[model samples]
Target: MFCCYESGFGKVNRFVALFARQSVVNEPPLGASDFKAAPLLQTHLLKHGQGGSGSAGSNFFRALALFGAGASGLLSCATIAYASDEAEHGLECPSYPWPHKGILSSYDHASIRRGHQVYQQVCASCHSMSLISYRDLVGVAYTEEETKAMAAEIEVVDGPNDEGEMFTRPGKLSDRFPQPYANEQAARFANGGAYPPDLSLITKARHDGQNYVFALLTGYRDPPAGVSVISASQALLCFVL
Candidate 1:
């Protein structure tokens, strides 16, 4: 079985952090070496000024302003070039303030219910939730009775009978959600070489999580004049409806 978790902090790191919290400042008296650079650095700084209380100072300010304008123009050009190159890396979506955003906030149950319904009616035909079971939905998206009823609706493949035959039975809370295809080869054939990925932990693997998924699902577009690209709808034409 595979499992995943984030290691936010370790014992050693925690100990160091605690020690840092209790730390007090201590200073050693400055030695001769500390003063060594002070006079020289001051002299260097003094040399940079064109003049003080003179026409030379006004000229220096004017030159400085001109240099600033030129530098700003170059920086803007570089910024444009960098943005053009970064454009090929792909677009970034603005962070949406979700309903459950803060540490104390909880997910919207209604939205969860609606998403599950959409997944069941549409995405389930192509995708699988292999890691999730009906029991997992209880109290999250549905009541225990509702989850059991949903589980029962799908016929599950079960163990061998007394005659040593594999049999189909009503699904139970313990049964994992079924795969659309029995195996990868069949899945590839059905989806034109693109095996639909399991939806379990799908968004978690993406950089922007569910927000990324929402953008991807809604970001379909026609390719530019001569460009061509295949999409899920094009590949799954047989099951698009």
Candidate 2:
């Protein structure tokens, strides 16, 4: 016998029992006539109201639903969880199809440049990369003069403190990025208790690195029947661009 609870407005109780008397050995050929045996006995108990008994069909269906629920619950409990996939149903090329291998390599310099442009226009409002010197922008193909000009635009304070008092500094690579909040605690408080993760090395640290980055940027979708997709506002990469 097994006992379980079914939750609705509150809770309902249920029980299922299975018993066998004796085992019978069967000879070969195993014809349908040779397999004649007694009918299996099955009972279902469901408590609905203060003083009420359920019909046979209702009890049988209830028992079936309970069994299905139990089996699904067991299977769900035993499964190992993994991150949801973002790949779509269609394929770009199918002749040499491989679910994992068939994915396109999406390293595009133009896209990275565009991403930088988007970052400067929007993300720079709340995030700053003090570790990334303007000089480092050269790696993204910016000219030396442009880098210097960009560096000069953001001033960094410097002076000797004879009296021993802290002063405001503009901005510098030596300084950590200027967070939207004073600290992680403050940031969490401001963003609905969700602390924004630092974006440094996000592209590199993610699994599959650049490919994952590209796919995630394009993954937002709508809800469906079994496990429908949802168009999400959440993403590490700036997908809007």
Instruction: Tell me how many clashing residue pairs each candidate has.
Output: 0, 2
Clashes of 1: 0
TM-score of each: 0.57, 0.42
lDDT of each: 0.65, 0.46
**How well is each residue in 214-234 modelled by candidate 2, as lDDT tens digits?**
665565454344653234534
Model 1: which ten-residue window has the lowest total lDDT? Answer: 1-10
Off by over 4 Å in 2: 1-110, 125-130, 155-160, 168-177, 224-241
**What is the Cα-based TM-score of model 1?**
0.57
Deviation in angstroms for 207 in model 2?
1.5
- Quote the positional error of residue 170 for candidate 2 in Å: 4.9
User: Which ranges of candidate 1 are over 4 A from the true structure?
Assistant: 1-89, 221-241
- Find the candidate with the highest lDDT and give its number: 1
- Cα RMSD for candidates in order: 16.8, 15.4
